[model samples]
Target: MIRGRHQEPAGERESGLADEAEGFLLAHAHRDQARREAEELCAGMPWLTTAQAEELTGHYVRRRLDVTRDLLLTTALRAGQLRQEYEARYAGLRRALLKRHAAGVCAVLVCVGGASALACLLAR
Candidate 1:
């Protein structure tokens, strides 16, 4: 029998699937928007022949998609960098909190011990 095989929990699996679906939908929407924008842009120029307008629209959509792809890639990279930075900051803050707590505990213990010793000596 395999021991300690790691498996994604059902909730996480479902969430992953949902995220994938959402990403797909978002990409579709972006493509549609880009196409619409291209059409709108070509519409502004009434002199273009039907074939030229279509060609220009196609070119515009392609360029928009390329720009969008590049922007998304850059944003993803920056998000990853930000995540790493935030994690590091969180870890540093956690360590500092723990050290402060330990120091507090030690200070309390020292004060209590000193007071107890003084009381005993005075009573003797």
Candidate 2:
């Protein structure tokens, strides 16, 4: 029960984990896109129009800055941290999905082998 409401029973745990993992991957990708888009919007703004940049920052950013370089460095670090977290979460979910699927497949193969052996003994 790593999460609630979406958690699956042992029988189908792999598929459920896969689904959840895939969802987060897609969401993370979208988050990455949004981040890039935001940066592009800032870069594309006219430097002559400091008002537009200020206006954009007013709405889209909230970092306090006594100096431009410090603010830029801090914000960049924050973004990097966010990216790392997104990638880490995605990897974690992917691993969970794979582990669950492997367990499930093993269980199924065991059941199938047991049934086949029983059938052969019955026929002989």
For each candidate in the order shown, give its overall lDDT on alpha carbons.
Answer: 0.94, 0.73
Model 2 TM: 0.44
- Model 2 root mean square deviation, Cα atoms: 17.3
Model 1, 86-117: lDDT tens per residue?
A: 99999999999999999999999999999999
Q: Given candidate 1, what's the lDDT at residue 78?
A: 100
lDDT of 1 at 91: 100
Off by over 4 Å in 1: 1-7
Number of the predicted model whose lDDT against the real structure is largest: 1
**lDDT per residue as tens, model 2, 1-124:** 4655675578698887888999688656654555565567878765636677656655443332223347657999999999999999999999999999999999999999999999999999
lDDT of 1 at 45: 95
